[model samples]
Target: MFFILDMFILAGIFGFLYGFLLQKADFCFTASLRDWISVRDSRIGKGVLVLIATAMIGWGIVLTLGLATVGEVWSMPIGFSNLIGGVLFGIGMTIAGSCASGALYRAGMGYIQFWIVIASMMIGNLLFALVYDPWASDYVMEPLQLAEGGFTLFQLNLPFLLIPLVIVALMLFIAFRQFGWSGVWQGAKDSLQDFKGNPFTKSHWDIRFVAVLLGIIATIQFVVMSSISITGPETRIAGVLLSFVFGDDFVYQNTYLNGMFADFPTIGLGPEETLVIFMIVGAFVSAILSKSFRIRKPKLARMPYAVGGGLLMGISSRMAPGCNIANVIPGIGGLSISSLIVVIGMAVGVFIATAYIFKMPLLLFQKMDFDDSGS
Candidate 1:
């Protein structure tokens, strides 16, 4: 009972932090892609690097201490499916104007378009479930296991965890040193500043801070995985509740149901689904407090973008074994090679879609003009 209560509390706190920071930072892959493709904004690019660097460092620490077993985290099969799935997910993000978590957070902010996007996502997931057989037969590489004993940085037989720690520390020092004291101070000031004037101010440094926090938050995944095995079911449960409230009677059956509620050592709800639901709730509560909630219909032409993008995410999440928030970070931190592939695929997908397909304009300039029009 106490452990269960602690899970709920930890989840709540985690969700709250994500909701608060995500809203404040406007940290959407969609926006980052837009900036990269259209306006050449490299802040988000820098942020991605920070996330990887910090995650690798943190993972090294956990490995040395034996605090958690990296062997348990989800990994991709690493082949054509990962590449294809990544491309599809990228396209969807461009069109929908957000990724899966981004959609939820925006929905919390009362964005009207994401209703359709989320609906499309669920539909896509259902379609994937139905067609999973062919996918299983054709594309999957043999599931990776730690027993195979492949070479890794740690596998090279380095002494003490401090070696990687020292390296990471040095790299971080160099990163800040390159920017100098003024840049460091400016970055610190900007992260704490109000969100009115310039959104990109000190964003490069802020990404590092966000990455560190995300790494800490990510440690919870170790606990979540050790305790649960019912990810898709939890997601389905939340979707069912929402669908029913909205008057939909879709009944999609999953084979994992009976096993989920059992208190057997290998059974329970997956963290991905639980985290997704609570994060949405946290975003909702945060938006209300920040008074940033507003409802507006998306442009008609953008509808296809939302629907198509969501469908792609559904397919990719299934193919890659998890979504960005779930599989990628934890997979990487846990030293799963498959997560690296998924991240690569996701990045490439974003690049191709943003550079070629969606081509959303650098709208920051236009947002100022839109404000000018109202004034």
Candidate 2:
């Protein structure tokens, strides 16, 4: 049908833009946390916050206009699952040298190591799918939902616009404070100037520029696809592949995998799968065009660490039931309490992992591991 075709086309367009901007900005969640914790450089982390704030503002406006409802808001329990899952995910990303989205983009750039990480991640998901039911029933509490009269920032009686505005102001202050007012103005003026050489090869985009563009793109994604989560496609793909390898009954009989497979309900590719395929293609195109694509092998010393990290990320993502892009981005936009808790847990996980990996004195001092060049 034309409707389905149109959805695929839109998904490709959005996926392309997502891949291109992510590649150009070199925006990896693990790097952002590591840089900030290790070096006191907050540019990348602040850019991520700006992206989240901008998405929140845009989503609010869309809600006010009745253009769309909040879609794909996870109602999982805000308890041990989020805490353990987030910490594991954080540690995993640190080891893997990239988060889920980061791995995808880097894989497109011909990093064979990321390809391995992707494979490990798929296996991890399969493991999670196998164990989710027992784990959820035994450990997870009842799902805490925002839609079912659960607490939310918007419900605090403050003006709805004020929350996002305040968040935006705080994020901007954090982002621009390192550069004095004069420096900020100068940087803006410089960003406006045109490149004198080849646009693709010579030009570099500012983090803020990419963040704003990401916000807009994410908003458009919500309008078109009625959902916005990078991990959804990956998870779905894993389910389909597992089903093929095993039997349909094996996958469908399992509770967690069945829920995932049932969401798509198709033997062929769906919108989420289409988005992921094009996202890789777009990243490949961008890397090639930018002259940055190269087949690089990971350091032998770090292979085990990378595989372990990928496994952790895969299992934790399903346990949390979301990744950074899926939970943090949209969760913050929707003002979910569980999302905030996950972010805190992730930060703690990053801190602990960084201390262990870099061998920092007292676990807080700066000790850069120049020998380890995985990221």
Candidate 3:
């Protein structure tokens, strides 16, 4: 019992940290993607890339020493599941205006619309129950599954060090050509300097600080919870409700359902659920502390998109057998082929949704985060 309590407490701490930092950084996968897609803003994307690189380094070190809870790389299976789900997820994020993590944290910031968005996500998860046996099994997922063990980085013993090394080299190469050694030295100095006042209580941290810290948190989460995703549990709330209505045995008909909730919580206290729940709580507290909490009424016109997008998010997250963060942070970090497919599918989905449905710009090659004149 105490051990369980300890795990929950740890998860709560991690969730709080994530929520606080995410809110401060205004980091959302959807926002990052949309900014790049609609207007070519790469500020958030660059931070996310840094976060992925950091997680790769951190998890790689932990895995190398066999310190992670799971003994091996927790690579997802290579299948159409990731591809199909990723596309759907990307569309959902665009529609809903936030990914699962972003919505949770934003909901914490007192967005009334996202609270509904959160509930809609649950509905989306249960909706999958209806499709799992009928069409998804033989037609959509199984026959389309291309590989059993995902094309994993572990298969080739790929070193995690390569990510940081390459990133450094790339940055230096750009900096040298642009600003020379003086600029590179200035960048290094700026990065290494300590934050003023209490770093923990402040908002608007550097993208690098936020990215590296988030990576550390992700590594800790993997080691502590042994779960690949927060989205899995977020959506599993629907599963728990599904089991409640259909009974566990009936719901267990789907193998994916069975595996996802193998240790289904009895008192709503599983490590996975606890983490997400506290994440919301943590974000709320962060918002309150930062005086950023304000109830923004959701526009009625946007509600349908939130509902539809959320449902799609729920379904696709499971379909991809991953989430936005999974595909980016750990997914890329682990170098899983399935993750790569999902990433591509998501980009495609975003392209379709943003360009066609919403009539957003499709300026793919435009220089992001540049001045209006592209200077």
Candidate 4:
């Protein structure tokens, strides 16, 4: 019970931090793609790189300390699923106007259209669940082998964690050297402040802080892993919850339950699943308090685009075995060749989504018919 309490506490803290940072940084990968493709903003990309670097460093430390194993990390197989699913998922994101993670995080900010998006997503997931049996039997790739055992840069005979950290840090420092710390000016401060004045300069210190927060989140993951030894489906926890609505046989096959539901049976929700729920709740509560909650109505005509995009997201995630956070962060940490493929898939998905699909002439023109706001 005390452990559960501790886990909740830890989850609350992490959730709060994630919400706070996300709100402040506007760290939506989908939006990042949109901004970069539509305009030209490297800040979002920089933020993502920082997160990857932080997770890598934290994961390396965990590996060295033997606190976590990379076995599960590399478990995802790469085959035709990689190319086909990835491309499809990319196409879905372009249509939906957000990625899976993007939907989760932004929904907390009170985006109303995401409400419909998620409903569609849930429907899409249910569709996946129905088809999973056949798909599992037929699709999926073989295990990928990395050159070395685990996630160390040493395996590749590269520099230590600090070396890459320093190099990246230096590059960012040079890039933002001239910015001011004000809200409206490039040289303004990066701290949470009103953007009423000059554009705030994002400080090196703040970047370091966010990076450290990300590292801390990784560390807490170790604690989470230790506290609850169960490693059932996490990304699909919502799917699991929805299974109840659909009479999931795996969850309630008998009076006592069975399958994945019974395989790792426990008294209550798993730590990570509970944590994810709290994260969403925490973000929502924070948004309400901060008065940042805003509803975005999808353009009526583009609704089909959103639906099509969402469907793609569902199918692709089912094929790829995970989404961005699921595959990339832990994937790189565990040094899975499949994850590297997923990263390639992610980049490919982003490019295909950004350039070919979302930015296409016909789609944009159609979208403009609904949202003449010139979004």
Model number with the top lDDT: 3
Cα lDDT for residue 368, model 3?
A: 46
- lDDT accuracy of residue 268 in candidate 3: 34
Per-candidate local distance difference test: 0.59, 0.73, 0.75, 0.55
> Per-residue alpha-carbon lDDT of model 3 for 122-233, expressed as tens digits?
7877667567767777777787687866665655645555654675568558758987999757755664454676655655566666888889888877776654466777
lDDT of 1 by residue, 105-148 (tens): 78777888886777777777656654654354334423422223
User: In candidate 1, which residue ranges exceed 4 Å CA deviation?
Assistant: 1-5, 134-156, 159-182, 193-208, 220-235, 238-272, 360-375
lDDT of 4 at 23: 52
Candidate 3: the clashing residue pairs are none
Q: Lowest summed-lDDT stretch of 10 residues in model 1?
A: 252-261
Q: Give the Å error, residue 235, model 2.
A: 1.6
lDDT of 4 at 96: 84
| TM-score: the better of candidates 3 and 4 | 3
Question: With candidate 2 superimposed using the best TM-score fit, by how many Å does residue 84's alpha carbon deviate from the native?
Answer: 1.5
- Model 4 bad stretches (over 4 Å): 1-5, 70-75, 139-212, 226-242, 246-263, 266-268, 295-297, 360-375
lDDT per residue as tens, model 4, 1-375 = 224567667765665556555554555656555555555556676666666666666666665566665443343654656656666666677678776656655777777666566556655654665565544433432232222233424245544355446645775666566442332244224422444443223211243345456556755665454321111234246456655675565445333123334434542355555655555565576566656667766678877876777666766676665665555456654455555666567667777777766554334445566687655
Candidate 2 lDDT for residue 183: 80
Candidates, ranked, TM-score:
2, 3, 1, 4
Best-to-worst lDDT order: 3, 2, 1, 4
TM-score, prediction 1? 0.74
- Model 3, position 311, has a per-residue lDDT of 86
Model 3, position 366: C-alpha lDDT score: 43
Better by lDDT, candidate 4 or 2: 2
